[model samples]
Target: MANVVVLLLSSYTSRLATSVLLFISVAHTQNTVVFQPSFLTATGPKTAALLLGNTSDISLYLRTVSPSSETGSIGPPSCVAEVTQWVLTREQVGKSAVRVRLSLDKNLRLCGQNETDADCCPKPLCVLETLQVSACVGGTPQASLLIQATIHALLVPSTAGSDNKTVIPNQVYQTLGSCPCDLTFGACDVRCCCDKDCSTETLKLFASHCLLGPFGGQVSPAPDYQCSVQSAEDSSDWFPFLCVQSPPENNPYLGLFYQGKTIATKRGPSFQRPILSAPLPDNVYLQGSPIFTVNDRYFTIPQKVLGRCVTNAPVAFLKNFEVECVTLLHSCPAGAPLQTLPKDLTVKVKNGQGGDAEVDVIEEVATDLSRFISSTDAVASSDERLACENVTLALDYKFYWKGNSITRISVTRTVGTISLNVALTTRYSAVFLNGEFAGEPNSGNPGYQVGLPVIAGIVDMLENDTGSIQRTSINLWKPVGDGFCSTAEKKPVLFGENSTSGCLLPVSGQNLTQCDLLRETVTSLQAALITATYVAKSGNPDYLTMTDWVNISYVTLNSSTSMDNNTSSCYGIPSHQHIHVWSLITSTVDGIPQRDIRAVQVSYSPSTWALDCGGGDVSSCVDPMETQLFPITSSVTFTDIPINTGPPKTRFQINFTEYDCNRNDVCWPELAFPITKYYTGEPYSQSLAKGLILVFFFVTASILGTPWRQIRQAWSCAAL
Candidate 1:
């Protein structure tokens, strides 16, 4: 399984409003303080607000506490509010007052569940309430303030017509009875679950658990999506498949498109509905009759604990039965498409059982393959191999239909358990293969070979074998555990084993059969791609550039590769890099050169393979070449000795060319390419010539400094 990295994002809201400060005083420089705007009028056009900011680097959070009930019952005393993320340093907000919006959604979830009550939300009571805002910096609350507000009730349709005589509206708690569905539009929550006209049982179920409440939005009337599911003022009616389903691990909250119509379900009270009535997402295909939903005996929704705190945010752990499906037998009404045993599928059956025979067959794989793939705990030598069973299972419902009547007799499938074993071969294979051992140089059919250190050689060759059997050609089913089932990218691969090394699965689930060696090696390459950044100083700009030094070897840049010199390419601040043609194929057929095969080989003999470490008799180190070549490949290439040029030069330096004005329009700053350099300046021959000339001048000056004594005497006589 690939190690997945997940990032979570949090959101907070702020509003701009005028300041309304009450008579209050506090010490300056204190970490805790409150902003202005204290009271809110529900009936007034302008709303009350409290704004906070100005803590330069500290993260500020304001947690709200509702007033106690003794104070004329603070409206919605159970209501609470908080700011999840307020990092004051990043975004600049001046001292001006900024309103902090105080509101909660209809979930009425005080915490994470949906336990509702009068105090669960801010009831529009227009009562004097104390809204206390506590300011915290760096998670420590330094101060708190009480903001007094006169709240007015917002008349919502759900409570607008409630009987005031009975504080608890009977309409708020009513029973839901069976009613016809909005066949054209699908289902209507208001007509059924929240229907004020419904029975007490129905409304109680709706209020307590039904997720379907109301839908209010502009509807585009069209032939395809024309849904006239009755407006709020219309007559009371019920709809099928409108109630909520709560399977322990199955969150039926996510709705789906059923048949042609979309029957969306929510997390609501079951109201004694059958589990088979729950709709599965589109991914799950049912081969049996639609009437199979009537089989309540087998597909029943189990009772679960309730009063779960709900929220608008998706419940990450909320179990979804979206793709879970089961096939059951049912007789369809006449005029149905002829039902016959699915030819593409099969079923296990018990035959010749006198009257009628029925059998069920299924295939289930391991729930979590990673559990069996590896163990950090040491196992006894005898218990090296492990098998995780029931990772995948297939159950088919095969029905034979004569006319409209259907008959499902048999269906069976087996899940083959994948068994993985770890064994220490202790130098199981040789790394070296000379011409003789490889059976003649250039002897194989349309063949190619790369020379490398024994370890690299094995990898490059095994890579070929892995390619020979295309990994993509073989389809691997996504495993069950340690992964998301919806997408393959999120699903766990290779049985949840993060690393495949020292792991081996039995070939075709057979104990005697060993897995393909090449496959095992290939599968182990699941670690993250390692990235390295290299920088090298230039010796001579004209002839030098950085090279890749990995595995203690310098991978040279191709001769034709040139370092970039376009400064304008990066906003007049140019960057450069070294690149080369990297390939691994020797040659091709039909007079074509195969993919370029680039290889570096390090070789040595450990035992009897070659001279055997000064060759005496015979000894071996995993065929001798392995352990010997391994160290050489990893230790030899780093050279303190400079890459020599034709001859030594007097002076040189890596130079950077500036961008001319003409390039400004064509530039875009993208990658921060490394500043690469190559050799530069005068040739060694020119410097040597200049040095010789200087030497000749120095000799001439020395000779001229004192003329020969005879020459001096002759000059004196001539003068006389």
Candidate 2:
């Protein structure tokens, strides 16, 4: 009996292996059926009808192929297959014969027992392995087509290392759901009525206030003239006669004809270059190419555009530029990193083989940290908050390059103490030098040019050594559009343009204190104006002379009290100042004009009201506390003057003769000066000859008048 059982088991195993091999062979031999024009028009006997066989065989095949173990009895198939049909119509060529084409739809339905409810059967119980499609003419079958179904299943491993694992089968179908706009998970969004997190009580607060009237705040569709119609106010009178009748599944292009063949179009090249995210070991640098650091990141610098600060602006190779931005520094220790410049720079240089090679250069940045609090110190250590007011924040970078590659770099940073909510100007400038010695830029060629900033410097006269003077660039008041008479930024004055800017000076305190502070502030502002200054004789500093400076003359009202009210006269404050700049244009012998600022005059005008006590004493004035605005204006004028080509001559001596031009009989005193021509010949002889001719014409005109006519009349009478 044991021998017989062993032989039987061996035979069963062999049959099972043969069946598995047969299934694989059938799957491979089945060709993919692709519908095409040739397949329908080929010369062959046409099929009249197509039908699918019973699906019970497919369920039995799946059960035979499934694995079983000794731990459990053989179970029914997990899925049962259902048939899907597709019908097609075909026409025979050059004949009045109607043919039928048939194909098995790839999608199949499966039904199975539900795990949650033993009695319930859910869809997708079994996967289809193979199906038979029969071609029949009337009731008799002519031929049959075998179709192997492709099964897609997701296998999930059993956690207990057992055979009890799940396989999820997927099918192709259309699905519908509500629009998803509430992206946030736990929290209820404001004005988002569709958010599930919004409870009934919370939704009631903003249900009607939704931005898009609920519906997940989705945008509404635009009005369509063909599909949308205006409804009448009274529903009883509304009619659909003029409304468009469209079906739910209407095709927009139905019944339209398409003629021309489709020609594929290729896109044009893009102007933007790809930014490098990783550093290149050795690469050539090009203009406007993104710069990279040694680390795998693009090099970025802080920049500002349209009054907004951008911290991640990528640095471009071989591009020299500057930017000014306003930033708020809250605390000293927190803003220390911003005050330091970038120290590591990755540059490209020319190699021995004439190719560009990239190298990393680390330089020490000049940093000033005395103004900021140390990171180790506590914020409450100081009594007063350390705030940098009206301080300059500058970042300067100098690059040394050979040909198109940079060889070296230098960076400098000058920052002030960080403050809370303070708007500070951050300036960045870059200079590229081909060689060590680079000359400074001039404002113009030979003289000051219009639209260019004026070159002005403060002159400090040495008291002991009167002949020596020290000159340094001075900052002038520049309007920053904050407010009238408010804090301003210092900038150089531009030539040839007239500008008026003012700032508010606060005068708040007791009577005496307000008066003193107001006077002091006015004095300081007036003193800060560029008065006695040294300027370059020409735009180019190479031609500067010792006497290149000019003193500013102040024009004031002829009053006993000074403009600053120094004598306590209680006079009105000089709140308005106008500076008049005069440029002298000297013409050379060749007629080339040379311009230089020869005179600068400033005038002061008092305000309408005086800040003084009723007794005319400014020291005791305490009427009100207010802020005063002081306006300063500057204008430029150009004068043309001839250059003295010859040696200096004495002034022309003239004898004055008193004559009354009011009397008709008396002739006015001869007041004429000789014209000194620069390029023309003498004109005295021509003038005298013309005067003699004019005298002769005058006498002829007199003779031709009354006296000559009377003499002729008397002679005629004596002859008669």
Candidate 3:
């Protein structure tokens, strides 16, 4: 009986243990598993919602629990919650067994007994600890299913920040402050009027005045509001009180709000001004401002667009510029108004009355268009076949200005008529002149400065005209690939640059008369190559004497040589010419340096070579009708004569002394010696003698004042 009783007790104990384990498993499953989302999403700043599985014949309830509450009891009623039936369409409910929707207020209240103790809720105010879903059957209350979770509802602050009264609005005012350029610390900054470090006495002693006034340079004067008021009063139906005030209110709301706890915006890498299609005109133009036009747009000229002419190239104020481009013009019939080069050009000027006025100062220019017509047979025929083509050859603009404002403008156009589809070269140049005092550019005061063109002219020494000298410029070889040389475009030679150029001369004739004409033409062209017989040393010739002029030496071309040669071969064809210029630099007794041209020598190659037909001696003459090509070249070289100017005028010179290491390999010891020396009242030898005497006295006192008896007694004790 005892054994059976023991077995029954053990069995009962095992059964009890099994039941406890099963209960624990069920509770763990309930707490760990949840059908709803883990977090509640915010729909608004203070409103949140959760999505979960839905079921019919079930009612749901929600409650908040403080994370710090250990007893699993409900904390303060911080948030309210509600549930709504969610209906999902077929597409949304595909293979889904549950649908859910629930909402909660994000503005949770804190647990405090009195209003004074109430404070802002924590970051995550309440946690949805448990969701009670009660299932009913046929109107009878049934068992409830508890879905345990640790979901948190975030307390999002409102973007408007209505509760925060001390928050400042995000706004920028254009008020002047202290000088922005005053970077120095604890010291007065030069030209900084608003610098607090600058005292009244120090400011008075400034060498230069402040560029910006007491206010910083960033501030501009407020526009005149009285002008608008007066204009409104002048109107028939307007009143002064009805005009809107220009000043801003003391507490104007900008309607800007913070989106989150921190207020910040992502900045761009670089800053660029906003571009406008047509810029508005301003009363006054600052530095680098675009030039204004009459049509409320920036002034622009036709510039090269992909190697072709296109309009609307903007120009800046106070800038001198020039551009050369090839342009095409549409056919203008015989009697149509010659297409003015610049179709739309009028400048707007400030009239000093708070308004802009248009000025038609651009003078209308007309040129003889017939002079550009091609004389070739093919071009002549093509010109008749097509309509007349008018083109602008050049456009020159002269702007007269007084103190940052343009007062007048002068435009001159050089136009010409040409054949169809012919590319025309157009030159555009602009210059700014001072309206107050307009004067020509000076080469120098008393001596010619470097880089100025040489003052030269031709002397026509004829039997009747002895003193008839015409002012002429140096010529450069310009070839257009027509097998002949041309000087249509003359480019002047500047000083100090040595240059050489050449062109092909075509000699063609059928008989003696044509040959003679060709020879004369060649002779005339060669003679005109170096027509300047004399050149002034300086730009101002009024104070120049006969010695100040430099005469050019060259071989005179005799026109009788070609006539004397009866042969068909052409003679006296100038092959090459060289110009040698010498410069002399000298100084006056007062040490003023001057530059003058010392000598000018012009030499030509031998002109004895004859061009004979049916021979390839100098140049190929394969065809009788074909033109014979002869090469013509010219060169100019400059040489400075070696002359003593004067003594050096430099006031300061520095020399560094170093030990010569190459003279001796053991020079490091000398270099290592210290340079600083200590000086005494007496000489070096006397100071050395005095230092030795002090050293001897100190040694004698240390040697004679010794304790010898104590030392002997200590030694005897050590021996014992």
Candidate 4:
């Protein structure tokens, strides 16, 4: 999974207003404070201090009590209006700027989940609200105030015994004051002090000096506990850390003039490293490219949190202050394709019985061949009457065809005793040829040196019992030679326990025999032509790649044999039936039939053979004999059933009969390999060939066509 990122921005402002009333020979400062015009609640009806700033970098600090004091009915009896204040701050050369704003905590309102009353219930938990104060300035030495602020009762409540108390419940609060002494622009100190224990001596001094006479009486005394409050809406209230210049200006030092500040740019003060910051802008890390080619939208803010309070203008006494925005963005990365393992293989075998038999046969051949002998030659005879007794036979043979040619042979056999009318086993005569052991004579032909090794069984049935004799049941062992078992006169050979390593059909059972040692290996050389076609149709190599194609060849690639010699190209024997299989991965699900595909061609040549014979003693020597080889000139094409289109489930039906070139007497219901494809997603769907039948044929044709094209071109030129 990938990740995503984003950005946001946050800023705020604060301001104050005031007035002086002269009546009956008295002059007094009557400060009315109001917050901004945009806030989530009302800010009024509470007691607070009204501090005024003057031009000498000084602030005239004063305290004012609300008309409805602690003993009063909470507010001005008949006046529901909020008292707005003009904030005045002294600038250089006796100039002062006046701005309007609401007071702190007292200007806030309350809320309840179920309360519907306009003044009391169902209020906003927190909202940005504002109030504009009427502008006013002081009569004394004044300075133009570039910025102003109104602090009110929304401040955290002071302990009851202390002056740190608030009139409104659940309201945010703040306060306003200036540097008590000469100070730099960002060096003012602010604090919240509990005024519960005002000294009588202090009150007496103020009254004697007439400082407390302006309000017509001695006012409530202030407290001594103090803390700093964060005004929610002030960018300067919190010193900024890193400031990115707005449009029309490219550098922070440029004083709103689109150029660098003369003094700050070249002087030592430079720019004060900002101490606070606003929030980030929005949509900074979204993916724009390879679309827009650039990502420039972003911002960053810094902040400190003190207990539950926060500050834009944080005081040195504050240990923790928090900065935050209403919304934030999360960052993430890009997308890419995922790789996974393939599903279960769709393997299949044409004949379940034969397939299992073949596996067992191969295992035996690769493992133990001597034990395979008894199981092969154990087929029961057709007409041996059952006498409730067992029958057995044994025969042995020796062939001396030393140079891969014709040679003489000898054989012998012994049969167990048995009654003729019952389950009979006969003793067999062992003939001798020139003082050498010959095979047992059968009723059909005497002393026929056939290789049917008998191990203790019936010798002769009768004249009419030629059924058993003709079927090679009678033993007549012989030797291996070129002319011994010629095409015109085929002979049976005992090929069970006595043979080197081969298949055998026992007389005790009806199982088919397997020839193990006599086998061929091949390579699929023409797979390139076949695979390119598949690649054009499928993008992924796993589906139809040449590497996955099963290669079928009659000759192993790196075997030690000449192209025209025996042991090469089907051992240079044109008469030998050599075949290759391009197996198909089939769905093993039941009820699917095999589909017919392409036809295979077997090409031949009698020019590929060599033989030699000689003795190291120089006593004898023999010339080589002839051998033939089959070569294919053209490839075949297999067209079968259509493939499945959708996912989750699919079935396949293949017909081997459509692919078979030779129609033999092998009997079965039919011959085909059936399978199904299991699909999980749209892109993984695939269509494979039916089986080895048609595929091999098409491959052979393709290999042959290449040379044929050149030959045809040459012939055409000669004729011209």
- Using all chains and alpha carbons, the TM-scores for the candidates as numbered come to 0.17, 0.36, 0.38, 0.13
**Of candidates 3 and 2, the better by TM-score:** 3
- Whichever of 1 and 2 has more TM-score, that candidate is 2
TM for candidate 2 is 0.36
Which candidate has the highest TM-score of all? Answer: 3
How many pairs collide in each candidate, listed in order? 46, 12, 1, 144
lDDT comparison, 1 vs 3, better candidate: 3
- Provide the clash count, candidate 3: 1
Tens digit per residue, CA lDDT, model 4, 1-720: 211211111123223323222122112223322211211223232212222222223333222223345665322112122443423232232122122222333223444446565543233333223332222344332211112223232333344566776554221111122112212333321221112233444445443233221132212211111111111111341223233324312212311223222334333453765543554332221111110111221111122245221212211110112222111101111110010111110112112111210101000011222321222223434433222111222222232222221133233322222222332111111122223433233321111112322211212345675412111221111223332222112122221212211111111101101111212111121211121111111111122133422212233233343443232222422222222112121221111222211222222222222222224522112211222222222122222335554454223213455333345455232333231222222211122233454678888887688887888899999999
Instruction: Name model 4 segments beyond 4 Å from true.
Output: 1-110, 113-132, 135-720
Work out how many backbone clashes candidate 1 has.
46
Q: Which candidate wins on lDDT? A: 3
Estimate, for each residue in 503-571, the C-alpha lDDT of model 3 and write its tens digit: 776654343226556656656665666667787665554322445566777765565654455434655
**1 versus 4: better TM-score goes to:** 1
- Sorting all predicted structures by lDDT, with the top scorer first, yields 3, 2, 1, 4
Model 4: weakest 10-residue lDDT segment is 356-365
**TM-score quality measure for candidate 3:** 0.38
Model 1 per-residue lDDT tens digits across residues 1-720 = 222212111112222234433443323343434444333332221233334333443333434446456884434212234542211212323442233444433222232235446443354443443445444555555434344444344443543564658344222222121132322344344435433355675566545344332221111111211122322212233321242333322422222222345456566678966567544332121222122222211221111124221111121111211122221112221221111223422322212121222433343343543433332334434443454333222232333432232234334432334433421110001111122221111212333222211111111224345311101110122323332212222121111122211111111112112223322322222111111122111111111112211121234324353323221111111011112212333434422333321322222211111122345533332242222210100112211222243555334212311232224443223121121112124433345456678779988877676665567788999999
